[model samples]
Target: MPKNVLILHASPRLNGNSQTLAETFAAGAEAAGHWVSRISLAQAQISPCQACGYCRGHQHRCRLEDDMDKIYPAILGADCVALAAPLYFYDWPAQLKLAIDRLYAFGPEYSIRDKETVLLMTAADQNPQSFGGAEATYQLALVDYLRWRDRGRILVGGLNEAGAIEGHPALIDAYKLGYTI
Candidate 1:
């Protein structure tokens, strides 16, 4: 059966390496008949979670309304969520992290356990340690805490300039990840 996959493009730069990888992944997923929706976090107006304990009393409805209103439904409807981001100072961009932090609105009933997840990342640094922080966070937060199934990840390094990842082999890897997910 086909799955509903949501691709969160967390890179602020348009057509950047990370976004390109995500688009390639989406293409393969589409070819394989899975429904894919790509959301650019840069364009979203999501606010940081205030840790205000509003959802607990309000039946999971967040008090501060913003673009998360749209994201909540998208997440609830997705069978898989793919996060594509570039390593900035060894971590995810603020846009993606903020959106994720807002997920606390769901509280204990968060739509996390059932969904499969993917991580696609790029970095200018070729050192393996460059990705350690991101990998650890992904494992600890999304995989361990939320219990989201690990689908696949494509981490490409040494791509700093614009369009640097255009001809990179990771594109094929990303496509394969999406196709096989």
Candidate 2:
């Protein structure tokens, strides 16, 4: 019953608080004997979607061949997908958004629906409302678009400095979520 999990870290900073939370979640998932793979979008050369509509016509395959080409297969094969990023201007970083948009390739035609997904995020502000937009996007774009069952979400606020999530309660919660997966 080990699920295949993919964690997409969208933080530009390698050790950013969000990335730390992602690592914590991954650790928990691994402890639970789930297969996990973590990919850092900040370090990867993922191209933005070109609205070419080629993928829509061509079997859910993106036309522009790049790192996205590499990621597409993983997305299809995953039993669970986790999107991790820091809140930026009440939304995810552009890199993450672009990568997400590109996933449009797997539109309704492909039937990549009913998978499981989790979202993990960190922000400088502690306001619970600060992450609404980003959370909404994940719900609509990833969960609804792919018809994935929502597993859960971990939103950590008031963490700005890099690695600030270390030893935080949210980190512990993330670990538990992963382990429970």
Clashes of each: 0, 1
Cα TM-score per model: 0.97, 0.95
Candidate 2 clashing pairs, residues 3+ apart or interchain: 114-147
Superposed by TM-score, candidate 2 places the C-alpha of residue 120 at a distance from the truth, in angstroms, of 0.4
- lDDT accuracy of residue 74 in candidate 1: 94
Model 2: how far residue 129 lies from native, Å: 0.6
What candidate 1 gets wrong by more than 4 Å, as runs, is: none
Clashing pairs in 1: none
Cα lDDT tens digits for candidate 2, 125-178: 989999999988888877766678888999989898897887899888899999
Candidate 1 per-residue C-alpha lDDT over 1-181 given as tens digits, one digit per residue, 9 for 90 to 100: 8999999888889899999999999999999999999889988999889888989999889998898899988998999999999999999889899998988887787655798999999999998788999999999989988889999878899999979998899899999998898
Name the best candidate (by lDDT). Answer: 1
Using TM-score as the measure, which candidate wins?
A: 1
TM-score of 2: 0.95
